[model samples]
Target chain A: MSAENAAGTPPLLDVKNLSVRYPLRSGVVEAVRGVSFVLGRERLGIVGESGSGKSQTGRAILGLTPQPGIVAADRLRFDGIDLLSLPPREMRRLRGRRISMVMQDPKYSLNPVMTVGAQIVEACRVQKLAGGRAAKDRALDMLAAVKIDDPRRVFGLYPHELSGGMGQRAMIAMMLVGEPDLLIADEPTSALDVTIQLEVLKILDELVATRGMGLVFISHDLRLVASFCDRVLVMYGGRIVEEVAAARLGEAGHPYTRGLLGSAPRLSGSVHPLPVLERDPAWLA
Target chain B: MAVPTPPAAQHDRGLPAPPAGLKAWLTSPAPASRTQARLGRFYRGWRGFVRNPAAMAGFVIVLLLLVVAASADLIATHSPTVAGDLRTERLLPPGGEFWLGTDDQARDIWSRIVHGSRVTLVVVLLVSVISMPVGLAVGTVSGYAGGVVDAVLMRITDIFLAFPRLVLALAFVAALGPGIENAIIAIAITAWPPYARLARAEALQLRGADFIAAAKLQGASPLRIVAVHIVPMCMPSVIVRVTLDMAGVILIAAGLGFLGLGAQPPQPEWGAMVASGRRFLIDQWWVAAMPGAAIFIVSLGFNLLGDGLRDVLDPKAAER
Candidate 1:
């Protein structure tokens, strides 16, 4: 814990040489293989098709990899604290207060029985706030901060009462209440409408820029990531094959990234048959 | 000269605004369902049963029974044990002076039925309170923890449930040997396993829900999670089981009494009353009919309540 190391820390959260393997009944499945990344106070997006283990890498960083899944890393640091060494109790304390996560679907992520305000208040109460009113005020402020109209009404409503877009916004409000150093948004806006998706992304962008919180945006769409994130990690077969700046995603050299770009339909471009992804057997190996 | 006005002014302006009225307030959309709203719904559903005609009728009958039981001092002319009062009238039928007739002891049968309700209700409520928590805790731990814990606990529940409840109660009474307290203990031991099994099944389903994960993520203590989330979520099923089991406890307690292990001597339990009256069925049908009817009413009350509550509380049932 040198002063220089703390001052010049590469990023708020730095994960180096991480590997995770799950022991199933049949055999071991390597979910992540030597994945490495640095997350500064900028949006970093990981884009991969399903089963590519992009989610596993994010989970491994937060020590949330499910049971029977072995998570190992040479270095997993969050604001100079060694993440892998923390006990379960301390890790739980860190989860919502310091390094919060916005899970993929609000429908599954939120507690259906809990009111949006209570859920947000519960998150704020994780760190033991002053009192009930303070927690409630903070929860309402967060709902308003996420650009929710009629925050008072929305706060009292249950998850089932909300539309998909409102649910995601409420979830974002809950995650960002503590203003964590790093916010890992796992498909945060996937369930939202196109208009609401832009609104949510804009709110996320504003929060990240204002608070200087590092973000790891996980998604399958490279185009959205390209426009929204600062740096992009193209994951294929649980490995980070190509890393490029957001604007330079068009010039990405890897065949998988090229395939992903080509597969996505363009609005203005004259259409022929869409490009099918060419599989490389070596990629699996 | 008339002047053209803006669209906004045409709708409202140029004159003083109309005062807000009750109609405006009534027409406003409801504010949202908060914790208070959820609690209000629960209370409304709970009170709805109180308003049911059958339950209300049963409640009145049960209440009258309780009043008779409680006023034994003024109601009963003589002690229950003073059998064959040779000087006084015997087997007096319902009349102006006798009022539902005199028993073999010349004690009022109606007064005894009232007092008998107090005893039955006490035993039923006591046994229920004691066993419900025991079943809920053991069942919740087994189901929610799963794996080894579930196997071990469920095996114990299986062993208890393997024996017939009456047989188990008889054995328990034989071990303790006679009296109302012993009967209650016997019934409590025999009755708890069903509740435990039901609660376990409920907890198993609730443990997998997203709220549990959400609670965990919020760093809620395990005890708080169990008390607040797990228990409340499983309560509807557990409560229905409780209502059903309460009737079972009352029947078992009465069975113990009939077997000569409950309410010794002059305590005047309904079961003992029926047992004593069985020999004189042809001569004294009222004695047997009265206490037998008490048992029937109690068990019927619980069964009907359990059925109604199960329907009202179960969301899946509502869907069907």
Candidate 2:
């Protein structure tokens, strides 16, 4: 934080007191409450359980919260543009060009009928970044960067034809082809095999490093986040309860985070019984 | 049952393996050519169609009718509308010059049945052409947009569906006056609601799909999303519905013709042919029976084709 501030460079994405609420017949469910974080040209991990509002926070930043959900914030800015007050057309322009999202599962995220290359080309085309042959070349290049050995063969394949690993790579290729400034990845590798997961992470790491883009890596795997991210935010009961450097995650003082860490299975140590997470009502408030 | 020998066992004798890259290329599951892939798809579709005997029979019947409709001039022995000699040729039985015999008006019944196919073909084609686009547009817009738009469009569709298809077509034809074009319009109007409902249901299911959301996040316009993403996905089901509905459309068109609101006098129409021959039904059974048989066969063809399409197009059915 000191090094970033000393350089006098504004964060790429800045958020203060962000909250997301969904209205239901019963009452309002506060999916994310007063969560705040700042992202620079580095990886920021948000780790939490399924209902801890980590994914909601990522979606709120992109203005992609589904219907019946309302997003309110004291301030939300992206590269000096006021995202909260920006017009929808302006917001749309900002999306995919400046900020892009890679959703959880490529199986459902990629268009089933469209060829992989066509979908990647479309992402570039929509932003007016490239078109026709140029878009095709850029898409092929991005596929190669993702380590797809034969981009030519994969270019003509439907999503269903590709394996789980190939589909995720295509999805990543589509997202990164636009050369967006900020990327939000929501549990991008949770659906893949262990080896494939490592390969995907390596690709993400290389792309982020070379491009110098900000990344919001949302996941529930505490160990993966600690190893991969520069900073970590632990969310619980719709709010971030702990924010620490990834290296210092072991020293986190929050009880919920401690409970989560304790529950994780260890390789060497043998314990008679595994610990379970216990919730407290005070965390909600 | 005898067990087949394993490839590994068969290759027990010392033999040199093929070059690595060549073996990989040969063993690769990719199709050799685009034509090969298309042929594979066609073969699978054919296999599925043949499995259902009723559908195969229906397909054959439809194919025969299509041939009859396309080559009406070459097949018919005489001009469909030309009247025979009233003094001698009137109400002749099935034998002599007339194959299916002459009607009460002395026109060749077989020629009338053959030429009537052209009218039926036109009605089915025109009705479907008009109805499908309108229905797809309405349904896609209603379902994708949801909320107020969905409510309004779907309610309108429900109102249309409330009436019996024939009764609605009859009413529309009654208002538009008697003619082939009017009959087409009437039937098209009555035919679109089912397609709209089907398309709407499909769109609703797809509206929240991850691909659609991804497209939206890519800043795709609403029109682009509906057209590129939503429409293509909805097409298989819509196509199945269209095939099934063609039979209904044909039946309704014939019904309109029977009520004197389609094809007019002197023109051969199956339903009108049946209606005119009813007076002489006991005396000359072939006149009504021939056209009735034609109607029954064509409708059966459409039904079978629709069923076959459903089995092939649906992935779940394909797995079974």
Candidate 3:
């Protein structure tokens, strides 16, 4: 809590007028349109529906937009460096070492052919952190840090061999092994069961608290985001419709936010039918 | 080495009359070291390979090929190349002093076939060694590096694929001049396009996979991603394909030899032997029939092995 950040110093990541567009034969489909936000060393959640560009925003931050998807941001800066102008080689050097992203599905994110330990060691060694035995030891330490009971046994395991929770933890370990300053987790716990979800979240929570790492937690679960994130950005039709403190999420003035809240089936309220969200034409504007 | 005690494992929950020593070691639920893990994986693949009867037959046949190629000189009763008492031995049928009869030159058929196994082995080995690497490299790079690189490499692959393999190989032999080495080179050149195609297809599938994306996000260079990750996933299929292709390679080598462009006279190349035997095909069937049967059996063996390997190594098959 006492770690210093002088007043005139920039935030960990600064994004202004960020847009991701995919050119189809028919027309240009703007996935994220003029979306802008800044992230400090805090847990910031982006909540949206399936096509709501939360994942794209996270990917765009790390410059992981797929080929042919044009990413344009007026000022996309990370740790005082201009991410927009950074060459691929320099971007690659910055990735995993200074900035890392944990993809949603651990099943797919972890390489099936490689052992968990080998993947972790690769992420570590490629950053020029440690070599040979030391890198291996560091990887093992990371697995244990994620609260995996038997790091040694799991290290030799292929991704398919591990259950969902274990694989998710191993994914986290691989991401955190390089010790990046900013971590972008894209719906990390969606594929996991309820109990496993909490465990994964706890691990992420601890890392953010102890290591002072900035986290962009992208998920659609309003309640989960409200409980976990310090602040929330509600995205609609590729734009930020509402931004509110996590505690005041219920009091958000946006009709879309109210519709999203109204749609959820609450155990306490004995409502016969859940309210469906009304499609708004003006949110795109 | 002293036998170390087993580490307490989570998998040891339902232990009822546990296994001991060798069986226990082989059946060990969790391997302690990297060597153990690799050996265990290989051992499992081997187990899968041997389970099917046809694959086993093919494996045995390939083994026979190796043994025969290795000790060709020791097994033969007479000299393969040197003519002996042409008056008595010429055009003799099977079950005489000569087995499988003699060629027009009065050389022993059995001896020639035995010695010819050596040539067959060399051609197969040389072709595979040269072709698989080339195909794998081109395919993986092209697939992983998409866009211009992908387009350019694929077009080049398409050009190679457009040619009929044997005709292209024949053309290569014509250009390079005839010899066993040149024939093998030609065969190798024709052989790699298919592998490159196969590898590229696999690379295309893998390049977009979540694991690859994860690696990309984590700063893995394109070369590292292609070689380390994409190539290995493509390996199981490549290996299966290569085994299958070996049969084709053997046949191609024999075809070149039959055309008199492969091994020179007196070397006992199977295809050349078949060519010579074809002269006396009507009356003296054993001369041609023997070499023809040898080629058929060897090719069949390689094919059976390849089929069995597919059952074991094919990822899709593994799921079933």
Candidate 4:
């Protein structure tokens, strides 16, 4: 971490302590609790089960915690701009322009009525990046960049017309069109085929390497994160239970991390009835 | 989208050529250009609409109304309101120079009914134009904003919706003074609440949709999100409602005209003609019946077309 910090250059994103609470009729339900991390130009993965606050944490960074969800933090800064206190109008300019998040389920994330090219073009031109023809060309180029074989033909297709993997790639293209510094991908490849997943990861890898983009990859697949990201954050009970280098994930000291690791089905194992993760009350503390 | 045929499948001869001409061009599996794609979409919807015979009848009736309204001047032989030789021509049976017979004032009933199509068209167009936007904007904004805004806007919509449509329109016309323009305003005011309610329901479902969230992530403002994202989703339903409501609007216009609160003397409004001819109904049945039948057929046309449109345009019905 110390070796990667260049002199006089701030990290692309910095979070001191961020918490998100959804106030319900019953009571306030805390979704993310005191999670803090700094992201440079490298891939960071968040591994957690559903309802473990992983997706909410990513949403908080993008200021997209759906209405009625309250967010607070000591400091949430992106490229030196105070995200916690920035005016909404200013925040909007930064949101998809400097930072963007890829949502789960491309079927729902992409507009059903709009053709793929129009949506991608909208993503590019939303920041006043380009107009009409140039934005359209960039959209087609982005589609091709995402490894779509026939970009022009696919561009005119609607979201429902595309297969799952193609829809996911189209969504990724929409997010990356503006070349944001930080990209938070939430379960991006969960709907994809294994081969398509690898192809998509290769696209993400290329973007991170060539564009120096900071990535927050959130998925429950621990092994995939370990193989793909440089650093990994393990979340449980609305908090970060462990943080470790992707290479040393096998050597993680935390019990929860080990439990998750032990629970995954291994190719070499003859073990039946894979280990069920047990709850520890103290982890919430 | 076009896949190559396998050698074994060659017996099919490359999926037989599309249809003969226009249908072939319009329903092409892979449209060559944007215009073709749009037309293809429309052609498919048109085909769906053509399947229902009742809806086709209604569609034809509406088409006839439009043509008749547009060319009323050319179609009506005599002036709609001009009276001639009252003692000799008045209340003549359906024959000779007066196909639908003469009215109490010796005016041609057929000419008047033909000309009255223009009045109906104007009322329908003006009412929809004035009210659809207002209802859509209010309902969409309220639903998207939710919370206090939703409650307030909805309560206001409730107040408007509580009144019986014709009663509300009648009250408005009585206050604004009797005339066709005021009648249209009254009808428009009464017509929008149902649209608002429909739009609000649609917006509620769409407000939490992922595509809307995606638009927000793209930094689209609330106004843009509502206008661009939410409104389009709600449009199919709104359009269905508009078509359905056209019947109601026309009814209210006729009701107002019946009460003498719309389309004063010489206007040739069907309802106004009915009102005047009702006095002579015993001896001159066609005088009142012709205009009344016109009202029934036109209203039925709108209702049938509206129902058929739901099957073609409403996403829920379209899915079914």
Leading candidate by DockQ: 3
Query: Which lDDT tens digits does candidate 2 get at residues B1-320?
Result: 13343343234243333223433323424534554456556666787789889989988988898899999999999889989888898888998799999998888999999999999998999998999999999999999999999999999999999999999989988899989999999999988988898898999999999988888778777777898888988887888899998998888888888888988989999999999988889988888889999998899899988888788878897887
| Lowest-sum lDDT 10-residue window in model 2 chain A | A1-10
* Ranked candidates (TM-score, high to low): 4, 2, 3, 1
Label model 4 with its docking quality class.
medium
Better of 1 and 2 by TM-score: 2
What candidate 2 gets wrong by more than 4 Å, as runs, is: A2-10, A278-280, B1-41, B315-320
Residue by residue across A130-178, what tens digits does model 4's lDDT show?
9899999999999999889999999999998899889988988898888
Clashes of 2: 0
**What TM-score results for chain B in every one of the models?**
0.79, 0.88, 0.86, 0.89
lDDT by residue for model 3 over B67-113, one digit each (tens)? 98898889887999998788888989887688888888999999999
DockQ of 3: 0.73
Model 2 TM-score relative to the real fold: 0.90
Lowest summed lDDT window (length 10), candidate 3 chain B: B9-18
| Residue-level error in angstroms, candidate 4, position B258 | 1.3
**What lDDT does each candidate get?**
0.79, 0.88, 0.89, 0.88
Q: Name the weakest run of 10 consecutive residues (lDDT summed) in model 1 chain B.
A: B24-33
Select the stronger candidate by lDDT from 1 and 2.
Answer: 2
With a 3 Å backbone cut-off (N, CA, C), the pairs that clash in candidate 4 are none
Candidates arranged by DockQ, highest first: 3, 4, 2, 1
Candidate 1, CAPRI quality class derived from DockQ: acceptable
Please say which candidate is ahead in DockQ: 1 or 2.
2
Name model 3 segments beyond 4 Å from true. Answer: A1-6, B1-15, B18-56, B85-88, B312-320
lDDT of 3 by residue, A1-285 (tens): 111356868888888999999998999989999998888899999999999999999899889899789999899999889998999999999999989988888899999889999999998877878989999999999999999999999999999999999999999899988889999999999999999899889998998789989999999999999999999999998999999989998899999999998887777968766577997988888
Q: All candidates: CA RMSD in angstroms?
A: 6.6, 5.1, 4.4, 3.9
TM-score of 3: 0.90
